[model samples]
Target chain A: MNSASEAQYREQPAKRLRNAAIRRTGSSAFMTLLGKECLELLRSFKLVWVPIVFVVLGIMQPLLSYFMPVLIEKAGNMPEGTVIEMPPPVGSQVLADTLSQFGLMGLLILALAFMGIVSGERNSGASALVLVKPVSHTSYLLSKWVSMMILTWGSLLLGYAAAWYYTWLLIDFVDVGPFMLSYVLFGLWFTFVLTATLLFSTFLRSAAGAAFSSLGVAVLLSMLAGLMPKYMGWSPGALSGLAYQAVTSEVLLPLNSVSWWSIATAVIGIAVLLMGSVVLLKRAPAHD
Target chain B: MTELLQVKGLTKSFGSVHAVKSIDFSIQEGRCVALLGPNGAGKTTTIRMLTGLLAPTSGEVRFHSLARGEDHRSLIGYLPQTPAFHNGMSGMEYVVYSGRLCGLSASDARKRAMELLERVGLASAAKRRVGGYSGGMKQRLGLAQALVHHPKLLVMDEPVSALDPLGRREVLRLLQELKSETTVLFSTHVLHDAEELCDDVVIIRDGEVALQGSLAAIRNEHRRPVIELKLEDAPHAINWAQSFLQKSRTDELRYSWLSEAELQGNRLYMTASHMDVARQGLMEELTEHKVPFSRLEVGYSSLEDLFMKVVSG
Candidate 1:
C-alpha cells in the first residue's frame, strides 16, 4: 500500500529542483534577512532609542561648551569685575568634541544594544531554525553586519546632523568638506567597533562578555593610538583621531599620508572580522 | 523506493572524545525512519550533523533528489529538539520570513505561511507575538515553517520530548499525518514512539549502531525461546535460584543448555539454546533440590527484553 502511493507521489516530484537551492540570489536573501533583522531591532525598540540617544548626546556637548564659561564664572568667588576673556568657541572644536562624545556614549549604547546580535539568536536556538534552510553563513553574517551598519551609521548621521545644527547656531560656521571628512572617518571607526562586537558575539557564549570584550578592544585601540600616533597611525583606531584632526587643523596634513592607510586598514579589519564571524558561525550554528 | 539521503562513514569527535563513531544509514524516500537511542547515545549529535547545524568530523552526508550538485539543505527541513524563534515577531511573520529565506517569493511565502498556519492550528495565534506562545504552540509553528518550502525530506530531533502529554499526543498525530507526505527522519529515546510511528528503527548505543533494520524484521530476528519462573518468597526457594544462577555462571558444562539466566528477587528469567533439554535439566534439578515455586511460564522474549539485552550486553 505504501509503495503504491510512493510511486504516485513521485509524479509531482519536489517543486524546488535544479538550482532551486541556488536560485535564491544573494541579494534577495540579503534583503530579506536585512529586513527581518531591522524589524527585530525596531520591535525591540533599539532602533528608536539608539538614534534618539545619539541625537541627544550630539546636542548636549555643544550646549555644555556654550554654557561652561558662565557656570564657571558664577561658581567662583572672584573680584567683582574680573572677566575671563572667553572667545566664542570654534564650530570645528565643538564638532570635534561631539565626535569624542560619540566615541564614548555612542560606542557604549551600540555595544550594549548589538552585543546580542548572533549570541542571542544562538542562545534562543533561533539560528538553528533559520540556518537549516539553505542560508549561507556568509549571507547570514553579512545580513547582520548590514543591519548593524544601518543602526550605527543611522545613529551617527542623525547625531552628527544634530551636532552640526547646534554648532552652526551657537558657534561659527564649520567647513562642509572637513565636516564630511570627519563624518566618514568617524563612521569607519564606528564600523570597526560594530564588527568587533559582532565577532565577539559569535565567539563568546555570554552576551556580557562579548559586549565587554569588544568595548575593551575599542578602548584599547583608541588609547594606544592616542599614546603613539606615528607608530599606530595605520591602525583602525587612528581613524577617530584623524577625524578629529581633519576638522581642527587648518590643513588636512596628517590625512595626506596616514589617513588612506588607516581607512584601508579599518575596512580590512571589518572584512576580516566578518569573515571570522562567518567561519565561527559555520562551525557551530546553535551557539554551543 | 529511491534512497533520499545517504549518510556514510559518519563520525564526529570533539577533541579526543567521540560523539558519534563511524556509522552508516540511509533514509528511503516516502518511509518514516526513527533514529532510536537512549540519552547521550549520540542521537542529537547525529541529527544535528544531518541538518547541517554541525559538521561531521570525518564523513559525508549525501542527498539524492531531482536537483543534483546542490547544497543538499534545500531538499530537507529540520526541527531541533527545542524549536527557537524570534519572540518579537508574530507567528505569521516568522513563518513568512522562514519561507522567504528558503527562496520562496513574497506572495508565495505569504500564501504558504497562511496555509500552513491553519494546517498547524495556529491561524488564530498567527498575529500574536511568538513570545506569548506556549511550548506546544511553538512546536506547532516550527512544524509549519519546516513544511512551508515543501522539502523532500523532513528531519526532527526529539520533536515531542519537550511537550506535555496532550501536546505529545497532538504532535504524534501530526507526525503520523506528515510521514505519509514525505520521508520523515526523527531521533527519539522513547521506544514506544518509535514502535508506534516508524517503519524502520536505527538503535544506537554508545556512538555505534546496536541494531538497525525494519521494526518487524528486528522483532522477529531478536525473538528468543525463554522461561519465566516466579518462585515462592521463602528463603529456601530464593537460595535455590541464587545457587542455580551461580552454577550457570561458573560451570558451563553442568548447565550447558542455559545460554543466559538472571535471578531477580524471587523470580528468574532464563533463556536457553535448546528449550527441551534445558527444561528437562531444570525440572530434574528442581525436583532434586525440592524447590518451591508458585508459577512456571514459557513464552517468547519481548522487544523490551531484547532491548535490555542489547543495551546491557
Candidate 2:
C-alpha cells in the first residue's frame, strides 16, 4: 500500500509539471482575447440571466395562448348568445406565437448584449490592457462578436426547445418537422441581426450610443421597407418579420421576389456589418 | 550591447497640445532607464507611444529583439499605470490568460503564471479573484502578467505609485531581481524611487528630456557641497556674512534665505559652498557686528533638490 501511494505521488508530480508547462506555452493572442471575453461574460452573469428570463417568457407565451380560452371560461366573461371562435393552439399557431415573441425579443436582447462589448472595455480601462497584448483590434472585436452570437443562439435554442415541449404537452399534438425548420430559419435571422447590432456596438464608443444607434438603424430599415419600393429586395426588416410569416404562412403584399432573396439579403447584411465592425475597430483609438 | 529600443525624434500630439515633442532616447540591452517628470509632463504619453498603444505623430520607435530579431511587439512587455483585469478570473487564471495572449500555449501559460505569482509574492492568493486583491496585489499581478512572457524589454508606467510602503519595497525589490534578465524602462515622478532602482535616469520636462545619464553621473555632475546656517537674531548678519565672504578671497559664494522666523528663537538659514568659508565668514562678520547665532550645518544636495531645480528651472 505504501509503495502504491508513493507511486501515485510520483506520477502526480510529473503530470502536474507537464500540465503547467503546457499552460504556459499554449497562450496565443487570439486565445487570450477569447479567454478574456469569456471571463467578462462570466463576471456579468446578469447578461446571461436577462436572455434566460426572456427565453423563459418565450416558453410561457405558447402555454398562455393555449390556455386563454379556459382561463376566460373560468373567469366567466362570456356573454349570452355570444360566439367566441377560438383558433386551435396546435400546429402553426403555437409555432407562430412562440416564434414572433421569441424572435423579436431575442433580437432586442442580443443587440443590447453586444452594446457594451467595446464601449464597456474602453470605459473600464480594459482596452489598454487588451491593446497592450499581442492581439490586434480585429481579433479583439471578432472574439466579442462571436461570443455574443454563441450566447444569443444558445439562449434562443433553449427557449425554442422549451416552448416546443410545453406546447406538445398542452395540446396533445406535436409537429417536429416544421418546428425544426422554423427554428433554423429563426436562428439564421437572429445571427444576421446580431451581427448588424455588433457592428454598431463596435462603431460607437459608448454603450448608450451603440444601443441607440442600433435601434435607429433597425427602425430606419423598417421605414425604408415601408416607404421605398426599390429597397424591398434587400431590406433586413423583412427578415425579422419573416420568421413569423413562415411559421404562420401569412401572406402580405406582393414584393415580386422569392424567399431566397430575404436569405441572401440577411447574408449580405451580416457580411457588411462584420466588415464594418472590423474597420471601426481598426480605426478606433487604442487608449480612449 | 545592441540597442534594444531606439526612439528617433518621437513626437505625439493630442489636438493642439503636443504631449511628447521630438524626444530622442534609447535603451541598450540589460539597462534600466527611469523616466522622471512632473505631472502632465508627457511621461505616460511617451511610454504609451513606445509600447505601440498610441501611434506617434512624427518619428519612429525601433525595437530590436535578441531572440526574434526586430519585431517590437514580441519583445516588449508593458504595465500600464492603472492595470485592470477581468473581474471574474482568479489571479492565476488572469496571469495565465495574459501569457496565452502573448503567444504561450495553455499549459505553458499556467506554469509561468504559477511561477510568476510565487515570484511576485502572490502565490497564496493565486486562486482568489483579481477583483478581490488589494491595489498593490493587483499591481504585482499586473507585473507578473507582463513578465510571464519573458520579453526582453519591460515598460512600466508609475508601477509603484499606488503601492503602500511595504508593497513599494516588495515591487522595487522584485524589479531589482529582474534587472539582470530584462531591460526595464519605468516612468515615475518619484525621484528617490528612480534613484533607488534605476541604473540610468531621464528627466522629462515640457515634453522633452531635461537630463539623461547614469544616476551616479547625474548626481556627481550636479553635486555641490554646502553648509546651512541658522541664526538666532541676526537678519542683517546673513547679508553681512555674504559680503565678508566675497572680500575674503574664498570661492564665490551664493546665499539664499530658506526661511525667516522667530519660533523658539529668531531662526534664519543661509546656504554657502564650503564649511570653512561659511564658518569663517560668519565668525568674522558676527564678531565685527557683535551679532549672535544658534544653528549652523552642512549637507549635500539630494536627488529631490536636483529634480526640483531642473523641473522648476
Candidate 3:
C-alpha cells in the first residue's frame, strides 16, 4: 500500500509534464490535421461540388422568382388573351427567398457533407492511426471543427454573392448592408445545424445516423419556433426566420431584442455543441 | 538489460463480455516479444490498451524509462492488424501527414517520410494513392508511418496474419530486420513466426496468460522425450497397442517411465520421463508378447506440442 501510494505520487509530475507537452504541440498538430481535412475535402471533390451546389441553389431562387409569372403563363392552359398580374419582385425579398432556399436544400447538403467528417475517419479506423500518435484529442476535434467552419462559411459566402449578383442583374437593387446582415443570420442558422451534425458524428458510430438525427433535431426546433413565436422567440431555430425578416425589411440595422436574443441563443448553442463534441471525441478518440 | 515496459494486470470488459482478463508481463529494451494467442484470445485488445488506443477497464501499462502516467504513446509506434489509411491520400502524403501529426515540422516530416518510404521499398510507389496499393505495399506503408517518429517501442497486431505467403515472407523479413533496431511487441497465432523472430513469448488462451517466458527457457523447461511405434496392420498388434495404455495405467513399477501413451489406428505414441528405460521396457515387452511392430523412433517434444496441449487443455 505504501509503495502504491508512492507510485501514484511519482506519477503526478510526469502527468503534468505529459500534459504540458501535449499543450505545446497541440496547436501544430491541429493545424496539420486541419490541412489534411481540407486536402481530403478537395481531393474528394466535395469542396468544389458542395459550393457549386450552393451556388446553383442560390441562383435558381432569383431566376425562378424573376420568371415565375412567365412560367405560370406558359405552363397554365389559359385563353390566348389571358394575362397574369404579378407584382415586380423586390430585390430584398428575392434575397430573402434565396436564404429560404438555402435554409432548406443548402442546410441539407451541409449536414450530409459534414456528417461523415469525424464518423468516417472513426469508422474507417483512420482516426485510430492518428490518435495513437502524440496528438491531443482536443486538437483532433477542433481541427475538424475549424475546417468544417471554413467550408461552410466559404460556400455560403460564394453562393450568397452569386445570388446577390443575379438579383441585382435581373431584379431591383438590394442594400448591401442589410443583405450581408441577413447572410450572417442565415449562416448562423446553418452553423447551428452543422454544429449539431458534428456533435452527433463525434458521438454516434454511423454517419447516416448522425446526419439524420441532427437534421431531425433541426427540423423539430424550427417547427417548434414556427409554431410558437412568442414562447420560442429566443430559440436558435428562430435565426432563419429572423434572417428573412432582416432582409425583407431592408433595415441596415435589424437588431431588435428578439433578434439579439435569437442570435445569442444560436451562438451559445453552437459553443455548447462544440464543447460537447470535444468532450465526446476525447472520451472515444477512436472507435474500431 | 533494463526493463522497457511493464503491463500490470491489464484487463478490459465490454459490458458483460470480458475481452481481456487480468494479464501481466514485462518487456526488456531491445528485445522482441511475441504475444502469442489464438483468435478471440484478446491479443488485439491487449495491444490496443498498450498502445493507448483502447482504455483499459483496470490496471495499467507502464513504460519504465519515464515516470508513471506519462503519455508513453510518443515512444510507441503502433500498427493495427488491418491498418486502414485515408484511401484518397498518396503513400508519401500519408507518411508525411503521420509524421506531422507526431509533431514533426513540415520539412523534417517530408525528409523522414522520404527516408522511411525508401527504406520500406515504397519510394517508387510513394506518389501512388494508397487505395491502389496492394496488400504488401500497404503493410509496408503502415510500417513506414509507424516508424516516422523513430519510436522506442514498436507495437504491431497480427502484422503478417492477413498476407499471402509471399507477402507474409516480405513482412516477416522486414520485421526480422526491425526487431534488431527497436523494442518490438507483436502478436501472432503462428508459433513458427514467434519462434523465428521473438526472444520472449507470452502465450494467451481465453484472455488469460497460459504461459510466458524467454523462448529458450520455455523450450528447455518443456522439453521431454517422445517415442513413436508404427505397428503392423493386424488385430494382434492393434490389441497389444490398446492394452499397453491400460497396462501402463495399472502397472506402476514396470511402466513408471511412461508418463503418457496413446494409440491411433495401428500407430502408438508415448511420452516418457526416461527415454532409455522406456525404450528398453517397450522392446522387451514387444519381444515377449510377440507384438508385430514395423518401426520405432525417438525424439523430443517441440514448442508446437506444448502449444497444442496448453491451448486445448
Candidate 4:
C-alpha cells in the first residue's frame, strides 16, 4: 500500500501490527493474472459444458460403431428370416473413430469458445484497465493461453478416458501403450489449433474472425495432409493421421522419421504462434 | 514538497491527428491535481500516457524516487473514463485480484480489499457480481481496486462524468475524501468538480496545455470582475440591451472598463477590467435610457470563468 492512503490515515490503530505481519509475500503478477483467468474460465461454464460435450461425443463414438450392423439390419426392409453377417468393429477402430469425432466436433467447440480469449478482453476495455498496471504483457497473454489449454486438455482427457472405458466394456480393449501414444499425438494437434487461435485472437478484433481464421488454418493443414500425406508428412496436420494409426495399432508406434519431423515442427510452430501473439498484443493492448 | 512524477513533452498521435501534443508537467507529492478540459481535449490521452497505458509518440515520463529500472506502473493506480470489470466477478474478488497483481499476498489482498470496499461505500455490494453493479457502483469499485495497492498516485479519467447526478455527487464526495489520503490526478470537463476537489488545475485545449498552476494562484492571476443582468424579456428591454452592447463595443474610452459583453437569450453577461467604472457607467445608462431589468449581480471571476475563457479562446 502507498504510504498515504485510507488504510493508513484511517486505520492507524492497527497499522504497526498489520504492517509487520503483512511483509511482502513475493507473489508475482503472473500468479495473480493466472488466478483471475482460471476464475473466468469456471464462471463462463466452459469448464463444465466443454467436458460434458466431449464426453457425450466420446461415448457416442464407440456405442454407434458397436451397434451399426444391428442398426443396418433392423432398418432395411428384409424378410423375417434374413440374416446380416456383419463383424463387430475392432477396439482400435472404435478408438480411432473417437479420435476423429474429437478432431471435428471438439475442435469446433474449442475454436468457437476460445476465439475471443484475447480479443474480447481488448474489446471490453478489461485489457486497458489491467494492462495499465505493473503486470507484464507476457503474463497477461500467457495466462489466457494457459487457461485455454487447461480447459481444452482437461476436456479431451476426460472424453478420451470415457471412450476408452466404454470401448473396453462393449468392444475389445485397446492396447494401453498404443492408446497413450495416440493421446500425445492427438494432444499435439489440439495444441496447434489452440496456438493458432490465440494468435488470431490477438490479430483480429472480431471474435468470429479469429475463430474462422484459426479453423481455416486447421482445415487447410488437414486437407493438405489428407490429400498428400508423403508431401505434408513433416507438418502438424500429419500428427492427427499418425494419431489414428497409433491408436489402431496393437503395438506401440515405432518412432518413424516423418513422425519425429512432424512432432518437432508442431512444437516449433506452437512456439512461433505464442511469440506472434505476444508481439501482436504488445502493439495494441486494447483497440475498438 | 518533492516532485513525485514528472512528464516531459508527452505526445500521442493517431495517424494525422495528434491526440496529445508535447505536454510537460510534474505532480507534487500529496497534491490533488485536476486535468481540466472540454470533451476531446486529450485529457484521457494524457492520463493514459502517465499510467504507461499509451505509448507516447515523443517525450518521457519519469517517476522520481522510484528504484532504478523499476517499472512505473505499480506506483500509480489508473481508472478509465468508463470503469469496466469482469462481469462474473464479485467486487471483493476484483479488488483482491488487483491487490495481488501489485504483489500482495492472498490474505493481505483479501484484507485490504474488504477495508477499501467499505471506504468506497461498496461494502454492501461486495458479494454481488459486478455485472449487476450500477455505473456509480462500478466507479466506486474501480476506485477500490485502484487503491488496493495503495499507489502513490491515483489517476482517473472522468471518474464521475458518466454517472447520474446522484451517482456523480457520491463519487465526487468519495474523491474529496480520497485526495487527502493519496495524490490524485483526475480529468474532467466539468469545472465544478475540479473547483470542488482539486488543489491544482491544469487546463488543456486542443491537445496542448493552456494553463497550469495552483487553484488559488490560477484563479487570482486570471480573475476579472463580472456583472450579469437578467432582462424582463419585453421587446423594449431587449431592444435597449442590444443597442447598449453595440454602443459599448464602438466607444473605446467611454466603455474602456468593459472588456467584453455577451447576450445569450435574456441574460446579459459583462466582464470588466475596472468594475466600479463600468458599473457606474452602466447604471447611469440604465437610468437615463429607462432600461427595464429583472436581476443584477456583481462578483469576481470564478474558476468557471477562467475555464470558459481558456477553453474557448
Best model per TM-score: 3
Cα lDDT of model 2 by residue, B139-188, tens digit: 99889988978988899999999888998998898999988889999999
DockQ for each of the predicted structures, in order? 0.73, 0.40, 0.71, 0.53
All candidates: CA RMSD (Å): 4.8, 9.3, 3.3, 6.2
Candidate 4 residue B31 Cα shift, in angstroms, is: 0.9
Candidate 1, Cα interface RMSD: 0.9
Q: Lowest summed-lDDT stretch of 10 residues in model 2 chain B?
A: B255-264
Q: B-chain TM-score, every candidate? A: 0.93, 0.83, 0.96, 0.86
The number of residue pairs in model 2 that clash at the backbone is 25
State the C-alpha lDDT per candidate. Answer: 0.89, 0.74, 0.90, 0.88
lDDT value, residue B282 of candidate 2: 59
lDDT per residue (tens digit) for residues A100-162 in model 1: 999998999899999999999999999999888878889998998999999999999999989
lDDT of 3 by residue, B1-313 (tens): 9999899999999999999999999999999999998899999999999988888999999988887787888999999888889999999999999998888889999999999999889999999999999988988999999999999999999999999999999899999999989999999999999999999999999989999999999999999899999999999989888888889888988899999888887779999999889889888999999999899999999999999988777
Best by DockQ: 1
Query: lDDT per residue, candidate 3, A77-118, as tens digits?
Result: 888998789999888888888888888888888888888989
Model 1 stretches with alpha carbons more than 4 Å out: A1-25, A73-82, A250-254, B66-69, B234-236, B246-257, B274-285
Instruction: Name the DockQ score for candidate 3.
Output: 0.71
Q: How far in Å is the alpha carbon of B182 misplaced in model 3?
A: 0.4
Docking class for model 1 is medium
Candidates by lDDT, descending order = 3, 1, 4, 2
